[model samples]
Target: MLILAPMEGLLDHGLRTALTRVDGVDRCVSEFIRITDQLLPLRSFTRIVPELLRGSRTPSGVPVRPQLLGSDPACLADNAARLAELQPAGIDLNFGCPAKTVNRHRGGVVLMDEPELMQAIVAAVRRAVPAHIAVSAKMRLGIDDERRALECAQALEAGGASELAVHARTKAQGYRPPAYWESIATVRQGVRLPVIANGDIWTVEDALRCRAVTGCSALMLGRGLVRRPALARAIRWHDAGRPMADADVDPCVAALPWPQVLPLLAEFWQDVCGRVERRHRAGRLKQWLNHLRHAYPEAQQAFDALRASNEPEAIAAWLLQHQELAALAARAPEVEMTA
Candidate 1:
């Protein structure tokens, strides 16, 4: 199955709606919920993975694995047990997030440097969740060195992880420089569980090349899919030797303009309402616009226009006047749903 990597601020409902129709994404993992203390309420778990509470699936019917992030083995296991009640497609342990807040908390990639701790956390979580629900993990090569990749993979597998997804950069790399696909090959050789390669797969060629180099059977897409929603489908079509048509996203995304972007922004904000603060809501919207700008140049203009207007109407009016590109809205209103 093609997996959509859980991006903290990028793969919210609206974004997921858009990417779900792209064709090959069989599943998505919700953004990680950091478990810092024991007795984390059931409501907190549902808030991070609201879809799981609703039905253990994405709006498009794609299975969503709820990912847990933490430093304490017992706390992680406690939360995993509560999440298991939701019957998610699986439980995913996150050891790959490179965020400073997470690392400073001794969660995420910081755990990679402590293999024994990592093993204890995974083993506890595996024992807590039901045997039927798959237990998986996503990780970086190591804290900063290549030697830690295989060792970390072995540790997780020994602890009963059903599968592993390795992002090809280390904690220190933090999305910069090149992703070390060769290191993923090393991790694959060190483990018996299925290995999924992630990082730098922006296009079909990149996917093909990564598979050839790592011999990994599956893939996890992150930034690449955000930049181009149809990418997953394109990769699949390319692999099958099938001709595919491109969505003229430039025109379509531009038609809504910056003004029009507000309501859509509001839609996603509301989806996570009561779960996140207003400041966080607004920040998440801006973060998406930052990435959306890559696909539509007009997005830059719209982004600039909406810089101050957090209100929906103000943002919408700004878009109407600035959007001079072909009115893609007139031709397609449904793409927003798929996007």
Candidate 2:
């Protein structure tokens, strides 16, 4: 299955709604809610995961699991229980985030350095929540080294993590290319539960390679999905039965006309603009355009022209008038038919 990665400050509900509407996204995790020293109010969890009150699902009907980020096992367990009371699809612990601010706060990848603490956190959370509710952990291979990857995975598993998602890089790698798929393989080998492969899976081919290298059956897509929304659908199609006959650009990426994807972006902007303060809406649109540019190279030009404008209407008009983007916007949903 393809899981959407919980990208802090990016994959907000609007983006999750839009992306999940695209085929092949099985489920997604919410932006990690940081827990420091106390229990958060119920409103806090509901606000971040509004879908929790909406069946814990995006409008498209895909589950959106709530993820917690904290250092103290007791605090984590307390929050996990509170989150469970809301009936989230599942609870995910954040250990793979490499943000320096988060690490400095004694959360995320920083905890990967302490397998015992990681184990304790997961165990506490597992014991706090009901037995039927699933508990999962996401972590990078290691902090400065990969030697302890196996230990970390084993610890989480022993602590009752139903599954482990490994961002295939050391804390030091910090989202760089050439994610160590080999390290993910090591973690999978050492654990009995599912070990998902993540990091640098920018294309369908990258996903295939990751699964092959790590012997992992599942993939956690992050920026790659943001760049190419059709990616998971493409990977599923290729993995189902077809031989991966192409080795050049991913067929899915090749099939999309950049100009055909603009309207979708515009629609997402429309939905998200009302959710945030007016001053912040433009930045959000630009943020998506930045990632979309990775796959739709033509977006680079449009973003350059409108990066300074905060008006959604002006940006949408500008995007629509440009043949490069307008054409992509006007293009049909080829991914649905072909994928």
Candidate 3:
């Protein structure tokens, strides 16, 4: 199963809708909703995961599980119960975030140091939500090292997490290379619940290697998917034993071509214009184009051209011109043949 990882600031509902529209993502976890001392208003949850209002599914129909982050067991349980009222696909607990601000507040990866507390938090949330709503958790290896990885996985399982997604890195190794897929194998062996491997899966080859090394069929994609929108589709093709081939690229890793990617970008920009504030709209588009640069040289050119401009109008004009160019290119061969 390919699940879209919940990136706090980057993967909001707009991007989620756009990415899931491309094929192969089975589900998605919403960016964590930080639970604190009290129960949050329902609007707060809906704002982060508008899918909640639409049956907890993206516009493309992929189910989205809402994730909650905090340190208090009872408070988390209370909020989980409240969130259950909205009927999400599932409830996910966040124990994997490595942000120092979150850790300083006794949330995120810091909880790994206290497996007992992590267990309690999961157990309480599991009990609070209805039996039908699945309760899952995502966690890193440990705060400083992998010493407590297995213990933490076992603790989450014992606390009633229906499944676990391990990010394959300790907090100290935040977003670095070499995601330690073998360590995921260790945790998978230690826990009875199904374990999903995460971290550093950038291409179809990486996905296959991660699955082979971790012995986990499931994967949660983050920056990888953001960089290559068709990554999940490519991975799915490979899994089905029918890989797609591109003349200029490796058959196993070739994703959506530049022309194909433009429409998706157009759709994303429309969504951003609808929801994001005017002042911040251009930055949002630039953020995605920056990631798209990894896969498409066109994206590099686009990014470089837009780097100095923050005006939404200028960006819109650029998109309009490129889209028109793509259209002309598509008709060029037919025009030449007729001549």
Candidate 4:
């Protein structure tokens, strides 16, 4: 299955709705839920996994697997048992996040450094959930080295993980150059469970290369799909020996009226800011616009004009003017010049 990676603060229901409407996405996972010592209230779970409240489908009806992130086996198991009430398609454990706060808490990649602890957590969650509910895991190669990855995979498999998704990088390599797909192949060889390769699959060629190198049956796309919505479709087409046009390069971003585009962009920023903080929202929105500029160059001008505005309405007005300019530029070539 071609799965979308669960990028925190980015893959909310609105974005998930936009992505799943495009082709080639088989399923998606939610952002990792941070579990503390407390038995999280059902309302908190519902808010974190809004899909459960919305008929177990994304706003677009895409199936989403809720991901759990924590260090305590018992807390995680309790949460998993509660999550079973929602009847998600599966339960996914997160030991792959490379964020410092998560690692510092010994919750994410840091757990990869402790194979026994990882096993205990997975085993407990596995036993807590119903037998029919599939339990899987996502992990990096290791805390700092690939040598320990096989051992970590073995531990999770022994603990009854149904499958493993291996992001081909160490914690230290966090989103760096050259993801080691070969490490995924090594893990596949060492484990008996189905392995899914993830990391640095930004294009169709990259997907083909990952499949050839890792020999895995499935793939998980993260930033690539976010940057180019048609990436997965193009990759599937290429794999079928019939490549699609690079229509993703010219996404209808520029064509959308400013009134339509600005609100969606603002909504994305608002959702993130609510989860993060006001001090960080501007920089985060700018980063998103930078990605958007890859598909619509006008996004850069809009981002520059709106970067300092704290008020969404003011930013929206400036975006409207820019969108009009882009529209005029598109039509000017077709009109005949007067003598």
Query: Highest lDDT among the candidates is held by which one?
Result: 3
Error of 3 at 317 (Å): 1.1
Write down the lDDT that model 3 would get. Answer: 0.92
Which ranges of candidate 3 are over 4 A from the true structure? 247-253, 336-339
- The number of clashing residue pairs in each candidate reads 7, 6, 0, 0
- The TM-score between candidate 1 and the true structure equals 0.83
Name the candidate, 2 or 4, with the larger lDDT value: 2
Model 2 misplaced regions, further than 4 Å? 241-250, 254-256, 319-339
Inter-residue clash pairs, candidate 2: 259-327, 259-328, 259-329, 260-328, 260-329, 261-328
Taking the tens digit of each residue's C-alpha lDDT, what string does model 1 give over 1-339? 579999886776556655664467988888888888876777887767777765777677878888999989998899899888888899999999989888988989989889888889999999998899999999998887777888889999989999999999998888986999998998898788999999998766788899999999699988877765666776776677765344443322322234444444445545544455655555555677777687656557757867776664454455444443334654466776778
Model 2 lDDT, full chain set: 0.85
lDDT of 2 by residue, 179-238 (tens): 999988988988899988899998877887888999998999999999898888778777
Q: Sorted by TM-score, highest first, which candidate order results?
A: 3, 2, 4, 1
What's the TM-score of each model vs. the native? 0.83, 0.90, 0.97, 0.84
Better of 2 and 4 by TM-score: 2
Which candidate comes out best when scored by TM-score? 3
In model 4, which range of ten residues has the least summed lDDT?
250-259
lDDT of 4 at 29: 85
Candidate 1 deviant stretches above 4 angstroms:
244-283, 304-308, 317-339
